[model samples]
Target: MTQAAIPPFHLAFPVHSFAAAREFYGDLLGCPEGRSSADWVDFNFYGHQIVAHLSPDEAGHRATSAVDGDAVPVRHFGVVLSVPQWEALADKLKQADTKFIIEPHIRFKGEVGEQATMFFLDRSGNAVEIKAFANMDSLFAK
Candidate 1:
């Protein structure tokens, strides 16, 4: 069987300011800027299309659920990166003094789905998570 190229996914989320979103996604995270307007901006987020729309009232994460001893934001979206990519991003975040809701650590350690993960909020309080699996096959392990 031939493996097909995965189609890129698109997500639209709220942000209070385009400047802040640009800085966070474009400058800090290294996502390239794409089509943009006064109300919204598109970013090349780890090869996916993510657009930030100006929406003050609906911008921040509002609820959380306890997961493996952390209060994980329920409204978060993220990408699964390689271990090295995860480590580098974690280091960059630390250097930027980014406050983490869930600091970088192994989740589900010594068990199925073991992974390195971190969670933080953007300038508009939108929660974002970045994680990596030591064994990529474990990503959907049962």
Candidate 2:
């Protein structure tokens, strides 16, 4: 059987406030904003659609999991970038004085499928991870 290629996806989630999300995702994360209305907003997050729907009650949920000795968010979203692009983003984050939950660093160093990864939180407290693989194909390698 032929394996189906993985393509980019669209994601939509609830947000407490659009104003806060706009400033955090658009201004801080540098994601370009697209079509929007009073009820929702769209962000071009690394070529994916991330729609923030207005829902104040759903704002405070937080989920976690243990990873690399840290409490990583289980309910989170992020993008996989090319190595150079990932480095560039790390530099930009450093320049912006962003606080990282997991600072950018190499993981599983010298091992098969080693990668560079980092995690940080958005204004609404949503955790986001940005990672790069030495060999892109290793992304799904065991």
Candidate 3:
């Protein structure tokens, strides 16, 4: 399937503070702002609607699962870009001195699902994973 054929999805996640959410989602991630209120803010996250709802008690990732030798955060969200775009974003993140939960690297090398992936957290402690495959068709290969 083509990227354009994938419909945009909506997500509503917790954030500890609106200010932190704004800087992380709006400024750092470069997502454009949408409708918002004092309790929540919406961002165009890579073409999808992701709202950051202020809820201090529910803002952090607390679970993990093993994946390719990494203790991958069980709760995370991100978009899949083309390899070049992913690499560019990785570079930008590195230049900003972003602390990665799992530094960017290719997983499943030489396997059906080989892909470049990385993990990091937003200021609110929400884990986010960004990835890209050498061949998009391999995204769901088994």
TM-score of each: 0.96, 0.87, 0.96
Could you give the C-alpha RMSD of every candidate to the true structure, in order shown?
Answer: 1.7, 2.6, 1.1
**Model 1 C-alpha lDDT versus the unseen true structure:** 0.94
lDDT of 3 by residue, 1-142 (tens): 4455888999999999888888888888799999999889999999999999989999989999999899999999999989999999999899989999999999999998999999999998999999998899888878
lDDT of 2: 0.84
Comparison by lDDT, 2 against 3, better one: 3
Shift in Å, residue 49, candidate 1: 0.4
Q: Candidate 1 on 9-117: residue-level lDDT in tens?
A: 9999999999999999999999999999989999999999999999989999999999999999999999999999999999999999999999999999999999999
Worst 10 residues of 1 by lDDT: 1-10
Per-residue lDDT over 1-142 for candidate 2, one digit per residue giving the tens place of the 0 to 100 score: 2236656689887788888899988997789999999899999998889999998776643777887667777878889888999999999899999899889998878877788999887766677889998788788777
TM-score of 2: 0.87
Query: How far is 37's C-alpha from truth in model 2 (Å)?
Result: 1.4
lDDT of each: 0.94, 0.84, 0.93
- How should the candidates be ordered by lDDT, best one leading? 1, 3, 2
- Backbone clash numbers for all candidates listed: 0, 0, 0
